[model samples]
Target: MTDDLQSWIGRTRRVADEMATPLVRRMAALTDRSDVALDRGAVVPNHWLTMLFDDAQPQSQLGPDGHPSKGDFLPPVPLPRRMLGGRRLTYHAPVHVGDALERETAIAAITPKVGRSGAMIFVMLRHTITGPNGLLAVEEQDVAYLEAKRNAPAPPEKPAETPTAEWRDAWRPDPVVLFRFSALAFNGHRIHYDADYARDGEGYPALVVNGSVSTLFLFEALLRRNPGRQIASYEARTMQPVFCDRPAFLCADAPGADGARNLWVEKDDGAMAIRIKTRLT
Candidate 1:
């Protein structure tokens, strides 16, 4: 392992936390942008659970990419660009609005590999969040870092036609939506907010959408379609980049006999950007 890689492995941080009632209501409101009425002790939805914990790094301490200067909890990968590659979440119990929570974060692994794009580093982070009752969720998230891009490539061609799904909804995500979500999640990533930096610095076409936000949207759609259903497990893979320049649609197939569900998000151009598989209890 490289000196930097050896330095980051096996590091961990545990944060004692609580879920404030006001923030719960605010997240529910920001979620649909409608009049959402929530009380203090109400059971918080799984999707909104992520809004409880904040990274809490001071602004001055952030890096040029707008994230907290790495090497603290996360590894200081030398690559200039970083993004979420995918996530797998296991939800064990429902969290209430005003519950005391504890979150433990650790660097599970740092994998170095060479791909078609270039030299890459895949950092796997394991987050275990527990509530007063018991363990609430265990999530494994993949964070990828890559070398700078010299030439921006054209976007993928639109699929011939979008596949039909039993349950689906369309969303037109704008800058405001992305900004509000970033604020709520305490994500300071410049690629999601800075158009010039995303284009010139990162070689993206426009401000990129947050991958977690996309996952939440799919989760919200799933819950909306099947009320009162709790997700036992969820695995999501980001197939393509979803940009702010176009609309995106969320589609889900009917559940199988085993109660397993399949879902995906398709860009306006009809390309599938994310695929989600879920098991409900």
Candidate 2:
């Protein structure tokens, strides 16, 4: 990494926000969990934090890709495309709605590499969340930047093979769902809502689903099936791009001997789009 890029490592920033009840209810509604109590004192799910603390950059500061222009909080890599690569989170305490929360974030690492498509850069960020009660959760997130590829050809499809699972749920994310998710995260990425831009500009066959949305769905499914099971820690990785309006299956295997459950989002073709591992308290 260039010295300039390396300087981004360990850079830290702190911000505060409130866990508003209305936003919590909106999140529940987005996940199709309107039954979730959104009373002021109700506990907010840790996964929902993904939609909070969004970078509210001014319109003039946004790049053509709709994200904040680089060289500010994040390093300015010349790459023209960006996406959420993966995340690992540890829940320390329950965060309640209406609580004022603080988040401290740091750039943990910056890695540059070459891929089949071209040059790439991976940024690792660490976030510590706290409330009046003290520490709430610690999260490590990965963001990837890539070279822009307009009209890129789709990869060849592989043979379908069903994965074993103890529980499964089907979800069809229409444009509305994608749009709402994008809005909730303050994500201005056109690929999630603009089908034309996604196809001709990004070379995606259809609108791409947000990685955080997929992660949220996995957690919702897990918690719904195993109510009251507290998640101590969880890690997730996006294996492939899941498009909007496609029928996807959220699958979870029986807990292993160590009590860690394996979860994944399976595309209609039986490919795993995202995989997760979680341990309960």
Best-matching candidate per TM-score? 2
Winner by lDDT: 2
Clash pairs detected, candidate 1: none
Per-residue lDDT over 152-235 for candidate 1, one digit per residue giving the tens place of the 0 to 100 score? 454454453444588768887789878888887788888888899988788888889888778778877787666776678888
Would you list the C-alpha lDDT of every candidate in the order shown? 0.79, 0.85
Clashing pairs in 2: none
Clashes of each: 0, 0
Please, what is the TM-score per model? 0.91, 0.93
Worst 10 residues of 2 by lDDT: 154-163
RMSD (Å) per prediction: 2.7, 2.1
lDDT string, candidate 2, 1-281, tens digits: 44579988999989888889878888988888856677888877777877878888899999877888999898998788888888999999988889999999999999988766778899999999999899999999999898888456535545334457998899887899889889877899888989999887877889999888888788888888877766789998877799998999989999999999888999888888888889877
Off by over 4 Å in 2: 150-163
